[model samples]
Target: MNITVCNPLLRTPLSLIVDDSCPVINLTYYWIHQRHAWKARHQPNIAPERWEGDTIQLKKIPPTIPADFAWEWAEWCWENGVKGKFSLIPYPAGIGRVDEGFPDFPTREYQAWLRIYRELIWPSFDLTPEMLTHTAVVDLDTFTLTEAWEQVEWVDPPVDNRLTDYIIIAMEMLDNVGIPCEGVTSPGAFGKRQEAAYARAVLTASQHVNNNPRPFYFLWLKHDELPDVPIWYPDKEKGVAIASIVSCAGDWFGGWTGYDLGDADRFITEDLQGGCLPPILEKELPCVLVGHWPGFYFNGEKSGFEILKTVKARLDAYDPDGTKTLWMKNSEIGHYWMARELTKLTVMEEPPQIHLSTQFPTANFTLALDTPVRHIQVNGWDLREVHSRRDFQTDTFLVEGKQTFVAFDLEVGKTELELIVA
Candidate 1:
């Protein structure tokens, strides 16, 4: 009698192809410039003399304690393959106008702060105007703002150009300060309108300022009943394509509940592994986590900084070679994911080549193989020795190699590739 044994290794596909969804640290600036305002409101007696002169001098004002916290957090991101989206709210509260309580633009003090941002903060992170003052629209002349309740109402299916105007203003401010304002993230809440004016405003601003379309990374909570996918606003006439990505985690600051170093570990082992990875792997979506600077520095001890470092360590351990996990700033990830969605992918079995044609030629994609790859060719040209990882499954009867992972870039137009298995 003749018996045959099935090879589990043979049953697996020669290569596993999937899109990469990188993790992002979405840090918001709510109180970066609000300390004076908070003091005036709570302890009026000790507040700094209200600056009545047109020229406010902030050069003498030392960096806020929170600025150090921010620097420390950014340092960890730089060291560890982590990227961040820092929301820059130019005016906090009591720093700008007397009545309306907005910072005066072009003031010497304001310029000093901008210089600090350009020199110190801008290098490590991508900046977003978290909406001027992060509150209601203010009248420069009257020194009054729109109703507080109606401030962020533009988010509710914005139909008018109010949000667009705000975005343009914010972009102009960043440009004046020499900060590249590539995207926008809404403050917090919105109303019930279905038109999606906020997203349209972001795209319009990007085209007007940067002369290109860009994606918006919105603050999304886990409990929010929204799909974790790129949201595209359909406008075929002008050929505007923009997407909104929902954040995967709640605010790192104890918004729902304070998260510490241990919480950071749980976020990776439980929440990220169980909640984010499944959807990303199954649906090919980006997994972005959002947090606020105030939340992380709630205790003034830089706990959030530690949490960020711990999260990076966990991610590094999960993918030591850094081939499987893609770490990028939120804006970069948004643009890349949008490009991947728009691109067309085709795989050939005979030559074992993957073909990608995309408007975005520089987008990155990963290819996983069951057998060791000898070499890879792109567009019929030989690529330099590519990095790959080997996996193995052991059993009592046999120890078989599982898969090898490879990452490559796809250029615009037809990109032909060939993979030789060793």
Candidate 2:
């Protein structure tokens, strides 16, 4: 019998990745001024035009996004079933530690924001630290931040131990605030050049802090020709791995600064003939949408959030019943990918059985077979066959036309699926 592994419930996976996100701090507003200072201290005096410009644009943008705005966004995602990754800058621009408190904000205000994040956002979103500081790299010994940007430090050399230590510190900061991280989001192409070392560091730190054997990161954003699956960095001998989750679409909702107002049509047109998502879905790849935290605020316009709403509405129109798409958190995607890649499946014609040896346990695991089946037994336990895909669940199988789909809670070790052909 010919068999294939399919996406959860045979539907395409959809996820989102937000960068430069923090609690109350608007990264765009801070980074602009901070970059100027860092560059001025550089030996070659490498400063960009944007850094040289006065803070005149600052008048239009707020210094902080505020807790109320964050609450509004969090509530929307909760009601809409939108799930993905969110970054928390442990020490945003070296301004303050999240576990401690920002110098500018009152202690009560900072604590209130943390409560909002830990309670409302933590449940639905995979919390990740975008390095220790989004702007400058911190010297652990001195507890002082270097003049070099975090991105520059990532590309400098192959300092595996040092990098791992840095990641541990970032993860620890979040952990101290009771938000454990299973992965990390690179800040401004951080670890782009040294991906292997970066992945190792991420896995080490994540496992050390959260005890997650499988960790993931979001670094590369490909506007075109996006990857259908995560690029894996595995250490099979140690039974630990990391997923380099790639963002397929551009930050079209709003720019990193929330200054550039992007059109929703770039993601999905009103007519549905164009945009990046349709093609990604057509290819049966995960439409990992990309955005920035500041952009969602749209400099207090909330225009970026509006764009997201339109895009979600258009997507809902595209898959009205949710039969065609499966919404997943970034960590869930990483876990599923790990199981998909590591699981060993064997078919035997003697008694019509399919054996699965999975390294990682995953939920809503689905398998497809060309043959029709009247009954299925998972290691001698009879699986209940569902009539429809929507009704499919753990230890349940569905037969649609000439294909047979099996859904189950995939567990570690060997699972034998004995089939009775129709």
Candidate 3:
């Protein structure tokens, strides 16, 4: 049977291919990789007795467990059949405590890792959220080699744990080796920034990455934060939508802020769990998975083939009828290489000649790209933005104190969006 699905944003119907690619899941590792490494011995060095570190525990996993807390979360994602992968963006600030136990600089392996991130990882992932590194070992001037060894053995952090670039590298490696991957982020990169990124992504997508039919996502294409992102997507307090500068998930209540969804959220929650994703799925907008934990790294390899299992679980729940279209996660995306290799999905698209504008309180406004874009959003209400803009072109967007979604295209006529917040 021809699987022709209706495109919500485009208002057209299109045939979809076998939906092999999983919806993007940003963060897999909740606390740290140690949990997965503890007891399980994903590696020889991870044996229980050998386990020696003050690690983080998954939020839900109780402190009483005392074991590798992160593992439980990984297991949760794995069990859920969610290919929720974590990015390797390092919070060097978190290193203060980790470094206290070490004698000094990292060993040769770590040095090699540093080089890999700088040379291969960074370029590969096109990472954001800059990382800070400290690769120095301090030795006691009066201590002998044996004494130094006794006091401090080795200082080695996972390549991915130390950087987001490594996370991309690992995901890319897995994709190269036939492993399905997804990338995630917290609420940080979700809202307004995501909108701009999507705009940029669409702009880049229309170009057809390196002559490839798919899209190309340059991590740092340009900082949308250049002017200042706004909180227009979700309103948290209203039990519905609010400001969304950059948000991972758009459910105002279910999102990061932890506000209870009144009616709309209830509807979406019911839709997702009921195995009938919201009609919102019809929108062409590429939504992001926001609830991800950082610190899952890979060596261009995915061990413990659990990705498919997780994917099945989410698929079974997210799209029982197989109508919604999803995009790959950030980490799983290496210069949008995965985007190119992914199966040809049957999502609908529209001509990229429209703009979706949202107004802020004080003469401030936000805008999105669309072609003859419809303005159905209820201002000061639902955290609404353009679902998807199929018809996009190359042009500079302008923003002032309030974020503006400018749609640029070298088309027959000049297309624009102006948000006059009154």
Candidate 4:
């Protein structure tokens, strides 16, 4: 007697077979505190240092000021395939005496620095308001600021209107300074309630201030479990979502305390292979590495910077053809991840078109097509095709037998795209 058995497995979903050829690497430089960095590096003797029995806390400080060094670093990023997000604060940590009036911008020196940032650095890096003052609480009513040690962490279950007011003030100040603040980095940790409250306030304020309701991403460094992908902090009441990108690496500046490039290398590799690649292979999430401004430079040399370059070189060697690795700014990574999370794609065979819709219609998204594309018409208009093999800046990539990838802006309503396959 013969017996036959039926199998239950079926074909894999197209969505599950997302293109894994493009892997993203994002860098976030935290505690940028540019003014403070300059002061600390230039006048180390006068700069505040935490004194212990055997050692002073500040270590491996830069020899000269950081302006030129920062400019050089930006230029290097432009030349190399690196992009990052910078945490910016209007006032340095210890800007004035405890009783001094709240710090304001357009200082002659800082204005000049802002010009440099706008012209040179802004293109390669996205800026986040690291808070108005890195460590002080400014009384909005009296315009008085308190010392760093005197202030406490912005409350976990934040004061009713204080967090909102603080966020708006920071955004407005960055705006006035001509810096586009797309996201924010919390100065310290927040509890679940605090995170939710903060998310609600950011959503409400961003909509009113910018007139564009884009998702705001909050970069938080410390996490007990390493995040496999960007975690979503959704405020259900407010209908807003904040993507929290985890830092897989230690503060590289902390290397001065004992950690070295080997530690950095291990962390970078873990983030690339353990943290980022697995998600990209399965869920299409990007990997973001966090560092500090001081960490990259030490005693007139690029300490963390050199380590990063070495890692990039290793990554390039690992993927020689450059099909599987992408260097992206923090904002770009956030945009793509947000778009992917919100997007819905439907293929209609009746009219032979692909329909794409998203909760965030105004956001931009990248589509990696497995099939050969002869033409693409977006919203009934044929998209202009530019055939170029430029490195670093090229938007299109080739995969599996001349597959086409295109980045397009999604509209609020249904976006119809006609793809004529070759």
Report backbone clashes per prediction: 6, 0, 47, 0
Best by lDDT: 2
Q: Can you tell me which runs of candidate 3 are displaced by over 4 Å?
A: 1-67, 97-267, 271-279, 292-315, 321-327, 331-422
Between candidates 2 and 4, name the one with more favorable TM-score: 2
TM-score of each: 0.66, 0.95, 0.29, 0.69
On TM-score, the leading prediction is: 2
**Candidate 2 segments whose C-alpha is farther than 4 A from its true place:** 43-47, 50-55, 235-238
For candidate 2, lDDT tens digit of each residue in 169-189?
999999998888879999878
Worst 10 residues of 2 by lDDT: 45-54
Candidate 3 residues 99-180, lDDT tens each?
1221233344333433343343333232222111111121224211211111122222222222223223323432332222
Would you give me the overall lDDT of model 2? 0.83
Candidate 2: residue 322 lDDT (0-100): 78
The global C-alpha lDDT for each of the candidates, from Candidate 1 onward, is: 0.48, 0.83, 0.26, 0.49
Q: Residue 40 of model 1: what lDDT? A: 58
User: How many steric clashes does model 2 contain?
Assistant: 0
Which RMSD values do the candidates have, in order? 10.6, 2.0, 17.9, 10.1
> Between 3 and 4, whose lDDT is larger?
4
Question: How much is 413 displaced in model 3, in angstroms?
Answer: 34
Local error of candidate 1 at residue 310 (angstroms): 3.3
